[model samples]
Target: MSGDDAQQHIYKTHGLLLNPIMCGVCGWQFYTLGIYNAHQWMQYGERPHAFRCHAQYL
Candidate 1:
């Protein structure tokens, strides 16, 4: 299936809402907490202060 179709299937199968958690710094929305955490780790490494926005806002 196409990427959009696969994503729709997963969301439907898991009963997930489309309202994702958005990053204040980059305006990127995360569908899951795990993915959000992973993005933070990959983007800013272990340093929380390195982020342009506050962690509490995330």
Candidate 2:
């Protein structure tokens, strides 16, 4: 596959759609639900910067 096609395939494989999801707590953008979930998992517990983020599509 070509470079662009390969990139699109990777994105699709990872559940990244056309819409962009933003983190409410940190204003970070995630292209896939898996990535968003990973971010939440990393922020869990009693860390100084711990926060719950609601994903908003933009």
Candidate 3:
């Protein structure tokens, strides 16, 4: 690939920092999506969601 192609790919990548918590009491990082999914489902139910913010990612 060309240098320009590499640069564009880097710029297009999306990143997110996840801070996991139990019952919104503690802020800890959940290493993987599987862990996060398990925690959310067990704690809040099948479709658990964050209640703190109203913004939804499109």
State the local distance difference test value for candidate 3.
0.45
RMSD of each: 10.6, 11.0, 10.3
Question: Which runs of model 1 end up more than 4 angstroms from their true locations?
Answer: 1-18, 47-58
Q: Pairing residues by index, what is the TM-score of model 1?
A: 0.42
Expressed as tens digits, the lDDT of each residue in 1-58 for candidate 3 is 8654444344345322233223453344564444555666666566544333533221
**Candidate 1, residues 1-58: lDDT per residue as tens digits?**
9655565566668855356767766879899655766777666664333232545432
Error of 2 at 35 (Å): 0.7
Model 2: worst 10 consecutive residues (lDDT sum): 45-54
Return the TM-score for each candidate structure. 0.42, 0.45, 0.34
Total clashing pairs for each candidate: 0, 0, 0
Indicate the worst ten consecutive residues by lDDT in candidate 3: 14-23
Give all candidates' CA lDDT scores: 0.61, 0.59, 0.45
Could you give me the TM-score of model 3 versus the true structure? 0.34
Q: After superposition, how far is residue 18 of candidate 1 from its true place, in Å?
A: 5.8
